[model samples]
Target: MDVRSSHPLGQHSGSEETGNEEPEQSVQRQSIIPSRMEDVICRLKDEVGYKKSFDVVVREMTLGDTRTAFFMMNGLAKDIALTEVLKRLSYLHGENMTSDALHSFMNLYVPAVQVEPEEDWNKMMTNVLAGSTAMFIEGENRALIIDAKSFPARGPEEPSLERVVRGSRDGFVETLMVNVSLVRRRLRDPRARYEVVRVGERTQTDVCIAYIDDIADMELVESIRDKIKAVHIDGLPLADKQLEEATVRLGWSPFPLVRYSERPDVVASHLLEGNVAVFVDTTPSVMILPTTFFDLVQHVEENRQTPFIGTYLRWVRFLGILVSMFLLPLWFLYVLQPQLLPPNLSFIGPSKEGKIPLVLQFLLAEFGVDLMRMAAVHTPSPLATAMSLVSAILVGDIAVKSGLFINEVILYMAVSAIGMFATPSYELGLANRIVRLVLIVSVAIFKVPGFIVGITAILLLLCFQRSFNRPYLWPFIPFDAKALLNIIFRMPVLESKTRPNLLRPQQRDKMPTGNGRS
Candidate 1:
């Protein structure tokens, strides 16, 4: 087999033979063709590029004058450890050595390592790229790949999104090893299982689905695995995107079927409830499968607060969603048909003196609000708040004074904006905004009845949507009393002892405590 080093040319200089030398002679006799290390280095340099330094060292050795060679690729090998191992192995020079002896030497000398012998060149290259050190001998058809991966890694840090007043601060990182460590560190139970799969044909991204083996339904886990396996995309930019595409029963549905979060505590809570969590390398977010509408609205922080406060917050969020979905459309309806509203609410109708079309007024206000939001988001942090204030005051004041839009329209848009903020997930919040537009148009055409019909259709669509055969509006639409309490009002941690039955979880119990007995 032709052998080459994955290093740069001229990085290391060794004696070159004028004609067929001992190493070359041995190569011909045993069919061990040696390509110049320079050729391999050139290929690596051409493929990976020259931005980063690539170094190689080649040293000639004679084990009982049998003629052998040692090659090391720098920056790829673990510092000091590989060098020390090489130093120890050098002592075997000028001693009669066989393939078995060399294998034995590597096995006994290497620390916490495994050697995979492969004759296929392609497989050897793949292993090398995956952080293994490949060793080829003069007469052997197979090459030994040693596991000496020591890439620089950063430890997990406190979560930014799912920050909790109580519970663990540790969160998953872009690294898969660190993420698995975080889960193992927290659960520490033997039942916790992680199944790793490679996706992204070109990128070959590592994705792992983790759940408690005994507690997680095997069928549910397999379903998740199959769905993920079915994904044939080039790369998954984030775990959420993959989950969105793979887990949703209806891709067109506005509601999110999978929940993506950065907090490990939130993931831990979901796993305990028999939800499957998927972690992808290079992304901080972990995707929770078979998520219901209630899951999107619920916050882990709410669980840390008092039950009463949590329930109140949930109601507030619900009201916010209602307002977000209807406010603008209702305003448009009030303008189009003042007689349909109750007497007390009739004041919302357009002023008799106003000449501009109500539709145009709403469109203008919506544009103004959106522009302000975009400005705030795109500006630098230090200037963002100031820009928001400037844009809000300028747009509201100018549009009202110029008679281009009404004050009431501005008020309704502001309310809708506030409602949009109430949504916990940014994706879900944006979806609400889109649905609100459709609802508003319906209400404008047919009044309150149209708005009601639009809402009913949305709810119906949601009920029809599923995540891995589990209802998207589970526990709420089905009216599961226990799940409803846990969904709408944050149930005490101890009382919430079972996973959602809608998912058909294998394990029914969450805690060991039975019937509230000690």
Candidate 2:
């Protein structure tokens, strides 16, 4: 009916308007739930399974002489809060509760945090299923929605992928509120906003768009909101990744357009830089939009160290990423075209040809590495290390020694795998693996031309890849020397003043200066 767009972490703009019916028609049409309480109960039995499901609890009680029922899922609504609510409502001793008494009860009696009214079945069902307690009163035109949601979640722990040696160990947990609180705990800015949007027709998943109102680009924020609203998925069982596919629309691109972080400090840092954080419910990882190539390549460990050490770390990481992408391709070239290598470097190519051709060797090696990676993921934690060691030592050594794979092939493949493991983003690493395989195949087929063409094609693709309409290559393709240098080197926090120019943030100043614009 009435819909609006407002700031995040605040009251919503309104129920997002779908435009199926007029605002007046929304109230006039009682298609799903009837106006009468008894009819509503009957509909719940037939539609919402009030009796058939054991977990669905409908607690009927007399409220101020009015027949009332509280509907909530068993595990979602907290027992203590529900008990408190029922106890307080039992104190009502007057005649049937008028509309005014119901309003008073919602305002004064219910100590639970969130309370709202709903009439439509669509909105009511969404709230009821998403851990909120729904209350229906006899003779009332609307039903009460009390926020009594509780989720099974673990305490924040260090992220397995993005762990820092010297920074805060507390990372985001599965709970949306806890994750938001983690960010708010670090970022106390008054302008910091977290706008909530519910996606998924069946799941009714809550996705929060977080940014600083003054510093973030309004267009960027609006773009994310509009795209999220357009997501017509029935459910987002995969959570953030599913939402990413819907919004980013990154069709066929192996590279990640959005950066994901489980660390709160990492999220707060991104928000301050004018990037919006898209938080999906039931997920610990938050997605940072308008990310560049450098964002995925970077790790928080660099920032945790001193400036000089941080710069060294950043450079080392960049080198590792480069090696992961190109080392195998270059090796393939050297093996085929030994004349291209200098006398000193000519020794780099494989000395002995194995039973399999170099091309097949590279392909099989790629498959083996990926197979081990997938196996490590599914393997138990205690055995993962041992399994990896056995696979690397026994399997790799035996393959090479038995002439199944040449010694040089095994060595180079192991080196490439090491570089891949050193990469900060697992998604990016996997993408690099695919690209590496492509390069190997190309070099194997066309030798010199394939090597050149493969590199050029990848560069063109990176240049074309857009992150929320911003250049994914950023300072490289568009060429901002200063920004590019900053991405390569970790500068002290105090030295960094201007927000990313690419974002076109409303407020350029990070420090309190006269606009602080460069």
Candidate 3:
């Protein structure tokens, strides 16, 4: 037995002792499938550990007087499908597998769409572990890798975060192929492509980069592909989040570099807009690359409604987001310096100061709200109402009564919280929360100057920030009036005639006609 890293496969570093070995020796290190059945069985038993791992199944059987071995993960292999294949193979006789056994067996017996020959031993084992059943014949040099994997997955329920009043209720599930099918069902264009890339050396997680070849910039697609390939990591256990962190150089900035969506419609819409969608296996969420600040702010419901209604909803949401980030800080500033307020608005500040400072009260209230929100997530549905009631009673009523929080602090915090909840992107909401907290602290210390500096710094950060080399604050910082207008108002589908110019798409016009109206 070889002593190596605790990795389940007992995998060794390829780089180690490579310099001393000759080129031929290094090439030889990559073993091919052995010709002899006994040799193959013995080697695979030792390498894959049939006795050690309960889930790794190796079924050795005599098919048409030919010895064959089937390597697969127990639960992953579709039992019914494999049984059908085996039933066909069981009917074979000695003469059926006499010459060209591998090709004959594959072409005649195997009834699978994704079945293919794999020559490399390491790759065959990897395929087996990844739920593909690998079939090795007695005389065949190459093995037949059967795609009979069936992962445990929930039905495509509507995504909780990006739900629309009137749209497709079906959302992306954890299964990669299923998610791809959802997208394919919507976008039937021949040019739409879903290129699969296996990332994570150990995990070998499947990542699909989806884009329309005709509409999307080839350079952008290649750039994203290269970045993903360059990620030399052991695994992507956390799925898309880990991949996003690895591919996108998102430094200390709190803002999201990519827009995440569980809705296939949203993903398809982005693909039509020339933006690339990255789908990670075992995770429902798909990442839309080169996202702008306005992208995070928009919702699917806006597109579902009429242009006028959608624009109104968009404006209300925008207002909510602004109020969430700035209302508390501004209110606190006013409480600190009453002179800043105009005649009618002079009564905005707290009537009487609480035992704690206005800033501390605001911070405490924010923390309590966040705590309650998290608690609600962990709490069962039946208890959620009771939990909310208790939280409201304790934080809202009792805290003010006990002189811990003033009425104004509670009032402004509640409004701010509503705005935060109204925000479409959860990541953007969290980022804004952090910014608000920093602003609150700044106001506590430097009063007026702090608010000014904090805002300016945030604007500078947004202006400088880039998502996949594209402006984060696009149509605003770079100043595209046409694009900016579209962001502000929900443009009707017919009105949106061009692909986003920022993406540098190969095809600019979305519709057939080049004129202003069709």
Highest lDDT among the candidates is held by which one?
3
Question: Candidate 3: deviation at residue 394, Å?
Answer: 2.3
Give each model's whole-structure lDDT: 0.69, 0.86, 0.88
lDDT of 2 at 130: 86
What TM-score does candidate 3 reach? 0.94
Q: Lowest-scoring 10 consecutive residues by lDDT in candidate 3?
A: 1-10
Error of 1 at 50 (Å): 9.6
Indicate which candidate wins on TM-score.
Answer: 3
Model 2 score (lDDT): 0.86
Worst 10 residues of 2 by lDDT: 1-10
The C-alpha stretches of model 1 lying farther than 4 A from their native spots are: 1-98, 112-124, 146-168, 237-243, 246-250, 350-356, 513-518
lDDT of 1 at 261: 87
Weakest lDDT window of 10 consecutive positions for candidate 1? 4-13
lDDT of 3 at 224: 97
Overall local distance difference test of candidate 3? 0.88
Residues 13-99 of candidate 3: C-alpha lDDT, one tens digit per residue: 565457543543445434667778888878877988876889988888999999998888899998888888888888989977647
